[model samples]
Each structure stands twice: as C-alpha cells, then as structure tokens.
Target: MAESENGATQPQQPQQAPKMNVLAQFVRDLSFENILSQKGAGGDVQPDVQVQVNLDAKKRSVENQYEVVLKLKVDSKSKSNGAQLFLLELDYVGVFNIENVPEDQLHPFLLIECPRMLFPFARRIVSDMSRDGGFPPLNLEMIDFLALYRAEIQRRQAATQAEASNAPTQ
Candidate 1:
C-alpha cells in the first residue's frame, strides 16, 4: 500500500493490461461419412446441406485459463432421391489464456472470441475431410457466435418464463 502526502493509502493498480491468448488448438474428434456410392453420389440430384454449430467452454484453473470447444455437425441429403449424401461431425478444442476480463463479459468472450479463433482451422479440416471422402469440399459459412449466444439466452429465458407461468398459482 502506498500513502499519499496526507497519509491516505492509494488504491492498488492493475499490474497488466487485459490479455487473451490462444495457447493451443487441436481437433479433439472428427468424423466424416459418405453415404452414397462413390461413382454417382449427388451427381444428378442437388443435395441439401445443413450445418449446426455449438460452443462449449470449461475453466482450466482458478486463474484465467480455459478450454473452449467448437462442435460442428453437418448433414447433406439429396432432395430428389431422399438419400443421404454426407455427414460430418467435428469437435475442435482450444486452450486459451484470458485475463482481466470482467465476469459478465467473460462468457461472451469465451463463447465468441475463442471459437472465432478456432474456426478457421476447424473449417479447413472439414473442407479437407469432405474432399478426401470423395465429395466436394464443404465450405462452411462464417458463423455469428454472438447472435447464437444471444438467441440461446433468449430461448432459455422464454422457457423459464413459460415454466413459471405454468406453475400452480399460490
């Protein structure tokens, strides 16, 4: 503690700037399936591709380290024949070191920023996997993680409100 000229102690100052880092990233799990015969898969028919993205975070320590995982699930089916074309599941994990982020802001940072950092690698993997599986490369569109997070929160809030309303009145 430091004392002022009049003997009042000065508040401690933060020792460092806000810091966020991607310590490491890796593919935790990857699965790809090609559902049609290699020769004529989706040749005549247009395939409908659906992609789902999910993000998860786990604190690594009492300090400011965390593990963020981005999961991508994709399915492609031929609309005309009702046949499956391809399916993919990927779990990409990143070890991050984050510090000085406020509690309220931390959740967004973990879900959005961390996953954004990991998306390119994960996307490349998906594209390569699809091409290697004898199909065209699957180019995933950019994800709006913040929107997804907000939407999920809104959904949970709506569910909670519905549950409260449905409860027996006191």
Candidate 2:
C-alpha cells in the first residue's frame, strides 16, 4: 500500500520461483565386461576402481524442454597385479521441463542440478551391473556436481588462453 496524492492500495506482482520437472529418464547405452571371469583368474585380490564422468545438455524442440546426458566410465583392476577385472560404461539421458530460470544460470542448472537428479539411478544401475557380473556390488561415491562444473569452466578458460597465446603472434 502506498499514498499517491490520494491514499490508495497497490497490488505488487509476485516473483515466480524457478521450476523444474523431469519429463523422462532413460539409459541410452550400457556396457559391462567381467574380464576376470573371461580370463579365469579368481583369487582374493584387492580391487582398484577408476571412474570418469562427462555431461552434456541441449535444448529440445519442444518449448521449455531440455535434454541432459550423463556419461560414465568405470574401470576396475586388481591392485596386486594391475590386471583388468571389469569395465562398465553407461550413458544416461534425462529430459527436463524448466521454467522461470534466468539465462545466465541455465547452463549450471542443466549440468549440475539435472545430473544430480539422475545420479542416484545411474549409481544403482552400476551397482547392480557389477553385482550381477559376479563381483561384489560397486557402490559409487556421491559426486560434487557443482565442483565439477566449476572445474570444467576453469579448464575451458585455460585452454582458450593457451590457444590465444599460441596464435603465431597474430
């Protein structure tokens, strides 16, 4: 309420909070190989596992829709002999309907928030695949998506700077 020349009540518009919904989620591709079984090597050996993650997001044809893909690669090896034990690669896709987010914040939201939403399912798939393949269930640790996003941005900026410096003095 405000007093103009004559006192009158004014209606204030409310700001809408950012909204996001998962329209669909699916596994685009999955591969699991139990190398130890294939090689007939069985013993009480310690496992060394390595994991890599990549993320990509793009706008969809439908209004306010976006598709985000999370790619994961896991490799396990025997700690003693360094022999390969198992390999797992998975590509997960999520379709989201998002609204009311500012343009500058959309990229991070898509990469960080969307993947965070999909990670639990992806992790479960990995655990099941590993267990089904004969070894113990491989429970993946929680990933810090915000840190990953920031590191990627820093890497790109560094690459751009290096390219500019090596531009043959143009």
Candidate 3:
C-alpha cells in the first residue's frame, strides 16, 4: 500500500526482482591455441587465417541450463614463405538459463543472443594472440545471427512437419 497525494493509502508495487527464468551468463568451454604448423615450424612467416564456426545448443542434465558452444578453428600459413604460422582452435561457450521458455524462443536465445554475447570476447582473443605471436592480427568476419537462427528454426520445423506427415494414420 502507498500514500496518495491527498493522504489516502493505495496499493504498493510488488517487491522482489523480476524472476529471470532464463539462463544467466556462464561459460561451458573456452580454448585458445597457438600451434605452429608443420611448414612454419622452422621458418619465419605470417599465417593465413581460415576460420570455421559451428554453433549448437545442449541442455545440462542436472541444472536444466542450456550450453551454447561456438567452435572456431583458425588455420593460417605464411603468405611469403608458405610456412605454417599459427593454427588456433577456439571453442567458446555461453551457459544460459532457458527454463520456462518455449521451443521457438529457445532457438532465438541460443542462436542469436548467446553468440552475440560470446563473439566479442572470442574476437579479442584471436586478435591479441596473433599480435603477440609475431604476426599481423587476424580480424574475423562478423557473424549473422538472425539469418542463422531463422535457418535453424525453419529446418527444425520442416523436419517436424515431415515426421508428422509420415506418421501412421489412426
């Protein structure tokens, strides 16, 4: 209850922070590698970065938290000397609480928001590592989370519809 302008008592707003029935920020996996390739082991050179990103979401059995893992593999070789400069593999993860969320919402949260949060940190690591490793920094291309999420959702829905159509008639 609250006091009104005229001194009348009124109902008060409810207390307690809104329950975020979603995943909080967390890390499921992280790896930074600076491995020199076979060709560059004995030579001086810069690595050509080839970055591959794989995204997926899985539920944790006990706590019900979802783990979104972004696997990045960077393969680089020297342009001048044709030597292996650095082959970096970064497996980044964002732990999200996904309780009480619908299936459609879950996909968006994992594909878009989770990756958006993790990308900057991962980008910094890759850039800094190459800079400190005696080579030009590698700048990764920006990821399109919206497109990816839509594709995944469409793919899942299609599969679901197909399965339903193929079911035995009652």
Best by lDDT: 2
Q: Model 3, range 91-113, lDDT digits (tens) per residue?
A: 77777665555655666766787
Which segments of candidate 3 are over 4 A away from where they belong? Answer: 1-47, 62-64, 80-82, 150-170
Q: What's the CA error at residue 79 for candidate 1, in Å?
A: 2.5
Global lDDT for candidate 1?
0.89
Please state every model's RMSD to the true fold in angstroms: 3.0, 2.6, 7.2
Q: Between the candidate structures 2 and 3, which one is better when assessed by lDDT?
A: 2
Between candidates 1 and 3, the one scoring higher on TM-score is: 1
Candidate 2, residues 65-160: lDDT per residue as tens digits? 999999999999999889999999999999999999999999999999999999999999999999999999999999999999999999999999
lDDT of 1 at 149: 90
Which pairs clash inside model 3? Answer: 1-12, 2-10, 22-97, 23-96, 23-97, 40-84, 48-77
Top-scoring candidate (TM-score) = 2
TM-score of 3: 0.60
